[model samples]
Target: MFLIVKSLMLVLMILMVLILVLNLCSMKTFYDKEKNSPFECGFDPKSNSRTPFSLQFFLIAIIFLIFDVEIALLLPIIKTYNMDNITLIITSNFFIIILLLGLIHEWNQGALNWLK
Candidate 1:
């Protein structure tokens, strides 16, 4: 315990010293114009950086990400279920039901429709 505490203190001191050195070295002079401007190779930019985005597309992407993550989460539960854990199975089932209900709600609300 003594050695562990000593080592941790040493690590903390080293980190503190490094952070101080970095803070001292990272000061920048006033050069905001160059920092804010886009880099131009020999040619000019064809289009503006800030373009209008479709809300529908964004919604679909968010839904896809949510479901994709849910699928990944479900996979681990599935692997664990093979070990014959009854409580986990019921919990997983409840979780799936909730997901299905959410999906149904979205479907009813026309969120799944592409043209909406």
Candidate 2:
């Protein structure tokens, strides 16, 4: 057991030394000029940065995130379905219903309205 532990420690030390050498070999001079420069994309920073964003864009983004997270929550339900679990199916439906009710409430409250 002591021999095995010592061998493992030796292997780890050699790997660490090799990693340090490789990192030093790959190091580049990152100066302030390179760091502060706008990226090489043809986009002009002055004009695009001042433009006002549309509310419709934000609303769609929020809805997309909400639904995206809902899909994340559904992954477990899918696993449960594969395992033939009825309780998980019912629980998943309950979560979907709650999301739908919240969406309806937001719609009624004009939170989801773009033209208001």
Candidate 3:
């Protein structure tokens, strides 16, 4: 126990010395304005860099991601079908039902509407 404690204290001291040396060596004293701004071939930008995004496209992408992940999860059930477990089958079915219900809810809420 005494040897372990001594080794740990040595490691801690070495780490502290390393951190202090790094902190003292790395310093940034200067900042340039032109270096930070977005470049447009040496010409001043004509428009704002930030633009508003479409919320409808964002929602559609999110829904697509959710369904994609659920499809991946459902694919494993095909491998488990050969097993002799009734509970596994029931659980997989229940998961599918939940996914369908979520889809129905999203549909009813008009989240799937792209035309509006």
Best by lDDT: 3
The parts of candidate 3 lying over 4 Å away from their true place are 1-47, 80-82
Model 2 lDDT tens row, 3-74: 999999999999999999998997566676765668734545656675666778677688879878987887
Candidate 3: give the clashing pairs.
none
Q: Estimated TM-score per prediction?
A: 0.53, 0.49, 0.53
What is candidate 1's lDDT per residue for 30-114, written digit by digit as tens? 6887665666543234576456667787888898999889888987886666556778878899989988998998899888898
Selected candidate, larger TM-score, 1 vs 2 = 1
Clashes of each: 0, 0, 0
**Ten contiguous residues minimizing lDDT sum, candidate 1:** 41-50
Against the true structure, candidate 1 has what lDDT?
0.81
lDDT of each: 0.81, 0.78, 0.85
Q: Kindly state the number of residue pairs that clash in model 1.
A: 0
Worst 10 residues of 3 by lDDT: 41-50
- How would you encode candidate 3's per-residue C-alpha lDDT over 17-65 as one tens digit per residue? 9999998887733476766677874446767556566789889999999
**Poorest 10 consecutive residues by lDDT, candidate 2:** 39-48
